[model samples]
Target chain A: MMELDENKKFSKILVPIDGSESSFKAAQFAIAIAHKFKSQIICLHVIVSPQPHEYANLSGLVTPKQIDKIIFDVKKETNLWFDRIKEHQNSENNKIEILTDVILTGLTPYGEITQYAENKKINLIVIGTKGKTKLKKLLLGSTASGVITYAHCPVLVVK
Target chain B: MKEFKKILTPIDGSEHSLSAASYALELAIKFLSEIHIISILPSKIKYGDSSGYFGMVPPKYFDKYKKEAEMWFEQLKNTIKSNEFNLDKIITEVITSPLSVSSAILEYGESKNVDLIVMGTKGKTGLRRLLIGSTAQEIVTYAHCPVMVVR
Candidate 1:
C-alpha cells in the first residue's frame, strides 16, 4: 500500500568511511550526489574498541593508558583521511558541505553507522560495497549488508 | 564519480517498486538522465516432477502476464505524462529471462551501461516486515554501478 512520496529529498547524506579504497570511491559518489542535491554530507569513521576478552590475557600488562594511546592514534589517522577528502573537494572547487566524525565505541561498525544516520535524520546513506575487511573474496562486505538491513532511510551502495 | 547519465529501475508491480520508480524519475529530472524501467518475467518454470527438468511456462499464462506488465507500464507512462517529463527520456521494457530476477536486472543494467540503479527495498512477494528483499540484496551486492535502494 506504499505510495510514492513526491516530497522525497536527499537533504542530508551519511557516508561511512573505513579509509579503504572502496570507501574513498564511495566518498566520491557521495560528493557527486551532494553536489547535485545541494545536500550536507556526514563522513563518519567508527573505530571498534578492543573487547575485554582478548585483553584479559594481558590484564595488568595492557594498561588503560595504552588503550587510550591506541585510540588516539587511530583518531589521528582518521583525521588525515578527512583532510584528504577536504583537499579533494577544495581542488574540485565544489562548495558542498562536508562534516567529519570519528567515533570509538564498543559496538559494531554497522550498528554505529546506522545509529548515527538515524540520530541525524539523514535521508540518504551512501556507503562503499566493501570496507577495510581483508576478506576480498566476499562480494559484499558484512558491514555494508548489515547497514543496508538496519538503515531507516534509503541506502546507496557505491561499487 | 561519473555523472548519473542513465538510471535503470526494475519494477515488479509492487507499491514499493512504484514508489521507487517515482523517486528515480525525480532524480532523472534533476540530472537530466535517461530513465529505463524494466520488468523481468521468468522464462523457465519448474513442473511437478522430482527430476530437474525446467520448461517454459504455458503460452496462455505468458500472454496474460505480458498483458498485465504492459498495463503496468501504461499506468507508469500516464504518471510520467502527468508530471510533464520528457517522454523520450523514459523507456519501459518487459524482459523474459531464464536467469533469476536479480541476475536479469543486473545483466540488463550492465548491457545498457547504466550509471545508477534505483530499486525498491522489497517487492510484492517480499514479507512486509523484512527490511530488504532478496532480489534487491543480490543486485546491491553484484551490480557494477551504484545502486540506490529506496524504502
Candidate 2:
C-alpha cells in the first residue's frame, strides 16, 4: 500500500564538496535526491584557507581588491564544476538546477555549511565525512560533528 | 535518480525523534520505500525513582519503554495513514543493547543492509561534547550508508 507521490518535492538541497572522495559520493547522492524532488542543488566549496595571503609573505603587497578578485576566480572555478555536474544530470529526465558557491570566510567548514543551510532554508543538507580531522582513533570529523549538532534542518551525511 | 529502497529510522520517543520520523516518513512516501523503525532500550534502566543505581535490567523494565515507543509509532502510522500515502509497510524492532545507542544502530543497520538512515539528534553543548560524546556523531562516524540527522 505504498505510494510514491510525484507531488512530494524538496525545494533546496546543499552539498559541501571538499574534493574528497566522500564529498563526491555525497554529491552523487545529493544529485539523485534533488533530481527526484525536482529541486535546486547548491554545491558549496569552502576555501580552507581564509587568509591565503597571510600564509604567503606578501601580506601588505596584495591589496583587498586582489583578494576579492582571487575569491571571484575561485567562485568561477566552483561554478564550472557545478556546471559540468549539471550537464551530466541533463541526461536524466529530472532536471536539477545547480547553484555553486565558494565561501571565503574564516568560519570552519561545518560552521559555513550550517549557516548556509539556515540562510537558504535548505530542506536537506548532504555532506561527506573524510574523517581526516577526527580527534580519536575512530570518529567523525569535528566539522561534521559540529554541523550535525548545530544545523537546524535535516542533514544527510555520507561517509 | 537514485531512489531509496529501505530506510532505517531509530526512534527514542523524544520530540526530536518525532520530528525526524516525520521527515523520514515524507521521504519514504516519496520513494515508496519500506520504513523500519528501530528503538533501542538501555540495558540499565534509568527512570525517575532510581537515582543512579546501575545494575542488570529485568525484561519487564524494558516492556514499558517498548510500549511507549510503540505508541510513538502508532502516532506515526496515523500521520501516514491520514496523508495521501497508502503505505503501511512499517517494520518495528526493539533491542536491548549493552553498547551505546549509536553503536547499536550502526550494527543493526549493517546487519539489515539498509540503504539509508534517518534519525534525530539532541546535540549537547560544546562543553558536553568534550565530556559525553553524542550518539548522532558516533552513528555518523561509523554508519556505512548515508545518515539523515533531523533536528
Candidate 3:
C-alpha cells in the first residue's frame, strides 16, 4: 500500500442521496466542503425494490413488460436528477468533482450507507436526517443516527 | 475573517480519534487557531436511576481514572508536539463525569467559547454507546458552534 501523505484533506467525501430537498442541501454542503478541502464528492442514491408482499404502485396483475418500463423510468429520473446537479454546479462556479451512484438495496437505507462509506474508504459522510419516509423518529433512531453510530468515517447529519 | 479561531476536539485515543485530531490540526493551520484536545471519562454504569448511587463514582475507580487520564493527556500532548501542522498552540484536557458525559462535553465547549468542535464518529463500542447513548449525535444536537466530525 502506498503511504498516505499527511497533507491530504477530505480525499473522498460521501453523500448518501435520496434526491430530496434535504439531500440536495446536503450535496450543496458537500460541494462547499470539497472546494475547501479539494476533495471528491461521492453521491450515493439507494433504490429499494418492493418485496413480493409489498405494495407496488401498479396493480398486482402487472406484466413483466410493465416492470421493465418502471425500471427504465426510475433510471431516467435518477439521471435527470444528476443532470440538474450538474446545472447547479455550473451556475455556482463550483469546480468540485462529483460521482453519482444509484444503488439497488434492501429497505435498510442507513445500513447500506454505512457499509458503502466504509467500503469506499470515505473520509467523511454528509447526509440528511429525515428520509423520504416521514415515520416518527425512535428517539435517536433516525437514519443519520444509524449512519453516525456505525459509520467508519465521520458523518454530518443535516437537519 | 476566518470563522474558526478556537477548536475543541474530544478523543478516546481510538484509531479514528487520531485521524480526527489531525484533521482538526489542519483546520487550525488554516485559521491560526488554538486546538484543545480533550478526553472525556465515561461513567461505566447506567445513570438516571434513583436506586443507584447518583452523581458519585467510586473513589478507588476515580483515583485509577485520574492517573490514566493524566497519561492519556501526556500522550496526546506529545503527539501534537511531534506533528508538523504549523499549529502554534495546543492544549489537552481530560473531563471526568459520573453521568451525562455528552452534556458535560457540550457544556465544557460552551464554557471555553470554542468556535468549532471536531471529533471522530467511531471509538466506543456499539453496546456501550447504546447503553449510554451516542455522544457525537448529542454534541451535534446541542453545540452552538459548527461541528466537523471525522471518521
Q: Which candidate leads the pack in lDDT?
A: 1
Q: B12 in model 1: Cα distance from truth in Å?
A: 0.4
Residue-wise C-alpha lDDT for candidate 1, range B1-151, written one tens digit per residue: 4589999999999988987887788788778899999998875663422332353456687788879888877777766544556888889888876678898899999999999999999999979789999999999989989999988
lDDT of 2 by residue, A77-108 (tens): 67766766677678787676888888776687
Task: Report model 2's TM-score to 2 decimal places.
Answer: 0.82
lDDT of candidate 3 at residue B128, scale 0 to 100: 39
User: What lDDT is reached at residue B95 by model 2?
Assistant: 84
lDDT of 1 by residue, A35-81 (tens): 87888999999988776665544453556776777778888899889
Residue pairs that clash (backbone atoms under 3 angstroms), model 2: none
lDDT of 2 at A119: 92
lDDT of 3 by residue, A80-145 (tens): 778776566666555778898877665688888888888898888987666666565432336777
Where model 1 places Cα greater than 4 Å from the true spot, the runs are A1-6, A53-70, B47-55, B79-84
Q: Which candidate order results from sorting by DockQ in descending order?
A: 1, 2, 3
Lowest summed lDDT across 10 adjacent residues in model 3 chain B is found at B124-133
Candidate 3 vs. truth: CA RMSD?
Answer: 5.4
DockQ list for all candidates: 0.59, 0.40, 0.27
RMSD of each: 3.3, 5.4, 5.4
